[model samples]
Target: MSNFAILITRRQFAITATATSRTVAQRVYVGKPDKISNIRPLAILKNKNDSPLETQLKELQMDTQQWHHKFWMNHNKMFSKSREEFDEKWFAKKQVSSSNQSETTKMLEPEDMAIFHRNFLHNNLEAQRTYDREWKTRNKKLLFLSAQVAFQRFYFKWFKSFFSRKS
Candidate 1:
């Protein structure tokens, strides 16, 4: 009975292996060559005789973007530094309190890191909430300002065209 089962298993394995090899062999690429011109690139801003107002607006946009990027970069750096300090302090405390100093001084396991993360988040929850609220308010104001600028530009263009046509 065992020999019969072994024979059946070997036959099934051989069948699956051959089937998979046949499917792989059938998956040859039979498509046309790709065209480089089909790919679309990002828009590049060009200063092609833009008006003074347009230039200033562009500069303002760039400056705000830079400020936003810098803020996030600095925030991330601060968060990382704080996390590292927390980890070090916690590890040191554990090492001092633990009777097995050598074991406690070893690298933190995933579970230990998780507990530290929870504690860190709990400690900074209020500060984090405040930062998030301020960020959201700033972003909302910036968006409104942008919309106002766009509407003003559109209205100015329409007014100029109307007067020009009358003249």
Candidate 2:
């Protein structure tokens, strides 16, 4: 009877151990997807009636717009990831040094993000300025090209209408 009891206890222990191991193995961490990785380039629509110059201008405008979108998407994504990493490190350090022994580990809250925001901006001020300058330049170029295309389209339509009315 004693031998049977020992065998039963050993089997139960083996089963429990296997179940625990399976659960532990199944636990996995999944990080958030990168914002920039999801960005799709803007499509350029071309008209069959467009003149060579008009087509070129439209292409240029589309390219500039795509570049602008890509730049901002990549920059913002990097900034967000950097901020997250900083917050994680800060929270981990705080958790280690904090005197409160009963508190649970937690991520930085939304309210706490202001501190990181200010610091990040301060550190990246030069890069921010450069980005702003480049962004404005590209925007101006895009606007000018778009306006030119619109004006050409309007002038062509007006010329056709005037000639057709006379005929």
Candidate 3:
């Protein structure tokens, strides 16, 4: 046998090890659906039915568009930081083995095991904190989206009322 496999670094080996264990996987999209139709369509203009409410509604829609743009921009910025934090906390630092231990002998002392467990617990705690932070951000975004949908439905109902009364 060649020594080619033995030449890989620990990081490379860890990556290959994890990659082989997965049976099925696919890329997932994390972006929120930003289509206007997905939210709700703004009031369509009626012929010769210009009203103050319609004007105000149009202005509010414009303001909402700006708010959405800002929200997404800020979310993208925060997302990067959150992802980095998650990665940092999720993976534990590689522990260097003493020179005396060989790859064949998988032996650990009680003190070493205790240290290992402590590190594991610390990493787990950090991972939980990271998860909570991400969950909060996701929920906040969901709430904002629900509010938008509610606003759109309300405005559309008002628009229909105005058009029906005008006819």
Candidate 4:
């Protein structure tokens, strides 16, 4: 195994040990759809013909900012680091034996583990390194994100209005 791969493995172990001491399985987000009480498109713009030129223009401009601010304010808090009321129970440490403690863990040797790790890195490292690379890449095709999200509130408010009017 190369020096770089060893360093990464060491760092990963260190972070996992410091942040969480369990053999914490891979972190996965379970996509659970919320139980909606009501599912209806919001009223947005009035009918294209009925609304007066000046009034519609003024309403759209004001509604757009309101929608954008509301959405962005909500989005910013997803990765919040609030410690208003400390939750130390979750961070409490637990005892963990070394991997070789059990008979099952005893089967693997340092050399074999190192070789397996190297193979794993070679096969899967590209995905692990993507976020660090995505910004640097000039292949615009690879940057599959859209700027619409920043403008989502504005766009959706207008959209909801149009769709609601049609129905």
lDDT of 2 by residue, 72-163 (tens): 77778778888668756775776655554225335456656787788778978887798789878877876787687667766776788799
Whole-model alpha-carbon lDDT for candidate 2: 0.59
Best of the candidates, lDDT: 2
Clashes of 2: 0
lDDT of each: 0.53, 0.59, 0.44, 0.35
Tell me the tens digit of each residue's lDDT in model 1 across 1-167. 01111111343232111112211111111122223222222211524544455555545555555455555555566668877786667767666654554566566678877887797678778867876886787677667665765676667767987999999
- How do the candidates rank by lDDT, highest first? 2, 1, 3, 4
The per-candidate count of clashes, in order, stands at 0, 0, 0, 2
Q: Tens digit of lDDT per residue, candidate 4, span 1-167?
A: 11211112343232111112122112112122223312111223333332243234435444543444443344333212221111121122222243423433434446655755575556556644763364345224222222332244345557887999999
Candidate 1 — worst ten consecutive residues by lDDT sum? Answer: 22-31
Better of 1 and 4 by lDDT: 1
Candidate 1: Cα lDDT at 78: 61
By summed lDDT, the worst window of 10 consecutive residues in model 3 runs over 15-24
Which of the predicted structures, 1 or 2, would earn the higher lDDT when compared with the native? 2
Segments of candidate 4 deviating more than 4 angstroms: 1-105, 123-146, 155-167
